[model samples]
Target: MSSNNNSRTLLVIALVAVVVAGTVPATVAGQAERTGGTVVVEEGETVDSLEAFGGTVIVEGTVTGDVSAVAGDVRIEGDVEGNLEAVGGSVTIAGTVQGDVEAAGGSVTITEDGVVGGTTSIGAGTVVVDGTLEGDAEIGAETIQLGESASIAGDLRYGGNLQGNTDAVAGDIEQDSSVGVDLAPTIQPIASWLFAAYALVLNLVLGAALLALFPRFSDGVADRVSSAPARSGLAGLGVLVGVPILLIALAITVIGIPFSIVGAFAFVLVVWIGIVYGRFAIGAWLLSLVGVGSRWLALLVGLVIGAALGLIPIVGGLLNLLVLLLGIGALAVGLYSHWRTARRREREPRRGVGPDGPTTD
Candidate 1:
């Protein structure tokens, strides 16, 4: 394939990795994974296991357990006592792996210093191995190059034409016609759609619960969003930006630390509430325009519409941000109004009954 085609293929591989990685729960097997941005295992560091999602993954240390990565690129120049599984745009190994190696990328390379004690499986656009493979090797690639120093103790099964294999030592070498077919293009969209569906269901359930528990309050908030959107939005922006600053300021003092902790938790909860409320407000307005008066219907419409718009790229992100701000602001405005009403009642003078009539002082 041409270089451009290879690059496109790699991009697809990276996308597949990102989509799959995003779906993993926060914790797995007693290990918390790092998501987004670079993940690195520096030299001299030893970890039980390593699992990374998105961005680049680089390992230069010793891992007692498996090293699994779904990212843009993966480079391992250390030792893995367990298996190594990497799926990304590019994968490179220049160290010793005690267990199996399963790698899929646009470009996969195992340098001369690399050694795999277990089987090695690879799917890529271009693959080069100048290392030692103690077990069988199953590779599917557009181009495969085996260095003269490469030594495979077991059978080698490959889909593409082999180069330098004449000088490399290996067991039985067979061609597998099925290995080179690319499935990423077909699978990525399906995976993304499933993720979106999952998110929609989760949001719908949460919205339903909120509406059920606080029907009147929910309606008031929705109305606030519809009637005073500009005010609500401004409030939301202030809360979003101001809350953190307040929290930090509180945390700076010894006595205010406890309050800060409580506030932090409350802030997270309020943000979630705002997101839901914002969507509900839009839905309620839309329903009003059509002369409908059903809270459930409004929530459904708003959430569905929000999810649909989220599918768009930049526009979707911008809209979601606006929705969040509006929802948060509306909540702030409502609370402030309640506080002011209470204060006003406290300040009002009481009326006393006189012989002739009632009198206020």
Candidate 2:
């Protein structure tokens, strides 16, 4: 049961990572693009960075910067000059990483030929180390195994059952199950509050950026939500319920997997944008009530109120959901309206004034 739970948690984490990687803009210097299919760095090839989702990621060449993936499997057979971060069904590293390795998944395996030059942190159902790690290892899993070939130059800290070859060398070995317990009742509430605060700040920052980048679209979404509350809410509810069903149906077909992944990514992106727009709308309304007309002030006030409401028990959750729905609907409607208007204008017959002073189409 514990192993099963851990596996499920890893799966959830992988999916969430996929959604995030699909939506968030990449900041890498080279090869920054989104793909629903596998990303391969073939032998003798090199890349500055790579981010992929849905399909397996195989790195058999070299990477000068970070490599991240959320997929079925991540296999590193060459060398990573920088950090490697991955969430997947399984992670297998048989290469050399000059920087850190952070992985969360069903299983993490560092082959006998693998070499990690920096810290290695992993959370999974099972972990097997049969390589050389020059830095500390922090692992949380249901089972951990260190093979005879394993050599760690730094401290080893782990939770859960452990088995290792006596020949395995490490600076120190320590068991710390208490860290796992802290994730439960003891500190969950505090963690939740901290996460909420962080989310509030992040949203505020993103919202401000969005307002600056697309002021007209932002205002249109907010106005639509205010002008058609019922319609927007209903549309949002439909999208919230319908999109997942569509994705699941698409996933049923083997050839449709990529499409489903892309759809899922788009859905998540829409929800996030909707939530930001909804919060901005709320802030705008609050400011209007106070006879203030500053978008910045409105955003600050709305975010504070929304974050506070989120702290509430059941009511807060429901309110947030409603707001999210409203925002999604409004954005969708506004975009559609704009597109239709553009199309109609393009289709209208061009008119010219003749010398007779009569307009002709």
Best by TM-score: 1
Q: By TM-score, how accurate is candidate 2? A: 0.51
RMSD of 1: 14.0
As a TM-score, model 1 comes out at: 0.54
Candidate 2 stretches greater than 4 Å from native: 1-186, 252-256, 358-361
Tens-digit lDDT string for candidate 1 (1-361): 5986776566556544543443332322234366644667778877789877655777787888998887667888999899998877789999999999988778899999999999998888889999999999888888899988788889988888788864465588889867645533333344345435655665676677677666887898999998888989999999999999999999999999999998997797688778878998899999999899999999989888878777777999899899999888988887788899999999999999999899998
Per-residue lDDT of 321 in model 2 = 88
Give the per-residue lDDT digits (tens) of candidate 2, residues 108-161.
Answer: 999999999999888777889999999998877888898989998898888888
Q: What are the TM-scores, per candidate, against the unseen true structure?
A: 0.54, 0.51
Span of 10 residues, lowest total lDDT, candidate 2: 179-188
Cα lDDT for residue 348, model 2? Answer: 88
